[model samples]
Target chain A: MGGSLLEQLPLFLSYSNVSFLAQAFGVTVALSIVGCVVGYTVGALLAFIRNRHVVDVLPARFLSVGFSETFRRVPFLVKLMVVFFAFEVVGMRVSMFTVTATTVALAAAAFSAEIMRAGLEALPESQWDAAESMNMGGVMSLRLWALPQSWKVILSPALSFTVGLIKSTSIASQISVFELTYAAKVLNERGFSPVLSFGSLLVLYFLICYPLNLYARRLERQLERPRGWKSGAPLLAESEAA
Target chain B: MHYLEIDRFTASYDGKEQVLVDVSIQIAKGEIISLIGPSGSGKSSLLRGLMGLLVPQSGEVMLDGEKVDYTNRKSVKALRERLAIVFQQYNLFQNMDALRNVTVAPVKIRKRNAREVEEEATALLRKVGLGDKLHAYPDELSGGQQQRVAIARALALKPDILLLDEVTSALDPELVSEVLDAIRILAAEGMTMLMVSHEMALVREISTRVVMMDRGRVIEEGSADRIFDNPRTRRCQAFVGKILSH
Candidate 1:
């Protein structure tokens, strides 16, 4: 346990499947981007539906609640299995990439809806009144004013969700998606040490997610500060003096 | 018939317990009326009802001798477009600068040309004494400045009437005068206004007529001098006494 893991890392590098690593990295990055885009669109639609008062009426209410609960409560692996198997059974014949992207997006959409709803809820009621008094009608006010403000509050959570999404793509390897985890698994099975292969995979995830986390935190701090308090000395000195 | 009439109006958050009970009021063209009341006396609700933000359970709201139809979407839009509201909270759009907050609705909803809207917004902001703060966001402005921007936003549409719901309540005591001063300018220009305020001095100075509300009912109303100097009802007298002493 005390020995340097980097020393043992050469054994894995010696087997040197550079092309496989490159393919895995490309697939992982592609999957994350596609998944986040699809997730954000679906999440925004779901949030709109859930937040709408018209949905309180009958089947829509029940369906929305059921959709939210089912997607949120079910494990992503089970969702992956259902999606892959169902598509196969229906003679749809999708690639493993399609299945993984769809599953990750569906899972992320459920979580993102809650994040967006929280952002919308955090806005003051007075904003709506102001918009109305400006002669801004229903959807126009929401599109122009409310959503822009909501985006600021939702930014940090949305970034965190994207990081989770990058990690969750590993589970796609179980469905033979050829992402980073699959490459690691193949290397481990081909006589490379399990510790080295898995360790490298962990490092790759950290490299992807750590900077994102830092940026999100930085944004959160920037937004939390009162406006006009950012000039170098006098503002800081005034705040401190107060 | 009055230009605006709210007859036998009653409203409640929950339908059962009416917050504004059988309230009736009338405003003639180019008139500025101030609604003065204690907290929870339903001044805001009455204003909201007239704006069609709240539907009175049983009442007739007439605009220019025609019944104002609250249920019809187009009519509601027309009515709302003709009238504007300024809130106690200075509900200026936080993400936008003062100019944009004033110009957005004109450009988007009213479909006015962007250049013309900007010019109009700038002029209105200047009128409210916020010409220098035109590019500043609401969060970047002081409370008084934000309220003035709110006033500019309301004025941009050039609505037939402006409803002010305790517009000065959220201001610091020292800041209240700045907002009241802007409002006084609007009144002096003969902008028809229905102001719900707790500022007795400002109300006395600016309002042509004052209506005092108590327990959701219009307890007293007359020329500003009559109501301010010699109250007729015990409720009005008590209300005025409490406010004056404070």
Candidate 2:
């Protein structure tokens, strides 16, 4: 009297089942947003410190570069495991969710710092001269002039990294965090209907990630648009009446 | 008192090859001193040193009898407040429109009233013949317009001396005159200027003093008429002869 797989599809895709998945999806989205915000702020500060050569002492330079380089070279999953286990060994007693989010945030911060460093380097040396000639202080010059231009170089990669970070959060299931993937794993084990179960999981991730991918593409197009073309200034704008 | 005096200033990039060697010059108020030299002859580097863009290997810069201490933040800040530079590259902030480029430093760094700064920026833009392109970004404006905006940006600071480091060199031949026109107007207004230029004709016309440099030293320097027409050194004569022949 076993029902067909088709019959099981409705059971898995039902309102009650969908609601459960939605709740877990909500957690994933919330964690990603918070991680990204915290990560980006930390990353920007790190970039500023490094870019300004804030501390010229050899030890300070070595430590800053070493810290960032280590995080960048290490695999995210390995770093996550190490951080989680290290906290346990140290008897921190923090919640698994907190540890996982912090690890992701740290990882994201390191990457964004690297991205910002490259963006800053791409700017011309004359830019600093221009800023200095105006009697602008270092921080003020960086905020008003340097960051705005560097952000143009940073935006696309950063958004794309965010999408990847969202996907990577699925790994949180291993840490026993109640995200969408955890819910999916639980349902798949109970039903043993891998097709319907994993298929539904796929749909949920697609729902979240597809939009980001599309937006990233749109942003690329918008950014690549010729400099003055952003406001859709007409052909005659260049030759406008004096 | 000299408005600006560069005494025995020597500058180098890597401490290996000197860019400016014992270069000394004095500029009076309202004087347009044009630095003329062949490529790699340290014309721009001299201007940069005056702007505090380079550290002198030895020697000092004095503005109005006060020593400019490039190593001290406060002194350099004060030095910059009175001395602004317009680079050949324009170096306009690409993120902002022309008006913001002119207003940002004044309002943000100088802590001037924003509204007043904006008003002055608007007027400066107009004076540069960029009144119509006030909102244009650096990349949107033509090279001529961008350079003019850069000049306007420098003017926003109300500097006592304006350093023009080959400001028109990067412009196309047709676009060069627009930027030069802006500088000419500034000159007419009696703005104190130290310019490094290759436009021999324009330099001859506008300069109060002409300095000729070769191999990182000032070989000949005098009144524009004397340096161009009645040069003293063989180096200056040959330099003028080649330029005049062309």
Candidate 3:
């Protein structure tokens, strides 16, 4: 006698709150894009310090170590609360957009630094020796080769982290950012069935995250195979004869 | 007067135990010298010191009879352009194709046109017997092939002297001959060379002079025949005997 979950989807689609849902989608997309861009810029700077051992200054090293550890250890919700509360205390009446972006970016940067450090450490020492032998200076060597190679190594992990960051952005709703989860919560409280509301939110998160995960995996597969493999073996033999 | 001279050179990696101590050597304009020693006996350290990768604690490295100013960047770059090293590990940039790897420093550091550098790199690769493999990455090549490409890369700059650091040590037995053949051709062309290696047969055949090192010191130096057939120092004789046995 009860309609199936699939039948309920059409009813949900025709719900009067469809415009609100569309607005929530827009906010979610904007928050993720802005958060990732700002996060990557700040993270890259932090990664440089971690890579170059520039954190040699005791205070600077302490700050970096403390910032990374504190963010990593605390829950994302806690970070959002702290950031929002701290800004409120300072009497800076910032918009929810600014607060959400800043909180997510700061949290994302700590994780990015760790990912980059692992990538850097995986590089062979011989790369440095080769660069030095060619008389390449420190900055030029990093710019020309080291950074590019490190990016290749970290690509998959970085992409996965980005997906995690997208899901975590849901927590920003707790601070009244009105992102996807916030809209779903408001709708569910208004007599929409809890199962349908929560289930759709779960489906939305999967739809957003799945394609990116597949793309990252595809790239990893492509990278694992040497580029232009068809001519590789014979070319090796020919070079030996030359 | 020698073209390059290292006098009373003393160096160590952590400044505690010495790796190269009170070592002196002279390289002539167009002669091949081989340095043979047991592992960890400072042969590679001496070469690295000459390249300014490791600065000696108390000594002088004179190039063309003038003290080399390692502190000066321009001077160091100039010196490096005239000197090229082939490492045991080949050390080719794995990301680059063979031709690009060979041409990179020449084009970037020497301000040469990339197209012109590519032509030179092609010729050098051909000389090392790798003409067809220009576009292959280092990971795709065999150890011998990679080492030969390394030789080509070194030659691309037209260096005044070539330093070979156990170039064939990392190769399989079957692959060693190919790399050695490339080195033999380089020797025939009268390239001034300083080689640190364990291949006694190759050293005896190609080296004009052999320097036998032991415990951070040159225990003996003379013609390769004398060093191999009839070493004078007890240490030299024993070292040679052990290598010959293997």
lDDT of 1 by residue, B1-246 (tens): 578888888877656778888888899978889999889998998887777666568878787777877777677777888888888888877767778788777767777766667788888989999888877888789999999998888888888889999998898989989998899899889999999998888888888789999788898989889997899998899888888888
Task: Kindly give the number of clashing pairs for every candidate.
Answer: 0, 0, 3
Which regions of candidate 2 fall more than 4 Å away from where they truly are? A1-3, A14-16, A53-62, A224-242
Ranking by TM-score: 2, 1, 3
- Which runs of model 3 end up more than 4 angstroms from their true locations? A1-11, A52-70, A85-92, A225-242, B69-75
Best by TM-score: 2
Q: Model 3: per-residue lDDT, tens digit, A1-242?
A: 14666776676777567778778878887888888888877776666666543233566555666777778788888888887888899999999888888888887788877777677777777667767777876566666566666666777998999899999889888778898899899877865677877777888788889998998998787766334322234434434454
TM-score of every candidate: 0.89, 0.90, 0.89
TM-score of 2: 0.90
Best by DockQ: 2
Model 3 TM-score, 2 decimals: 0.89
Q: Rank the candidates by lDDT, best first.
A: 2, 3, 1
Best by lDDT: 2
| lDDT digits (tens) for residues B88-138 of candidate 3 | 898877667888788777766666766667778888899988988988888
Give the CAPRI rating of model 1: acceptable
Per residue, candidate 1 scores C-alpha lDDT tens digits across A127-175 of 8767765556546756766677776688898899889878988999887
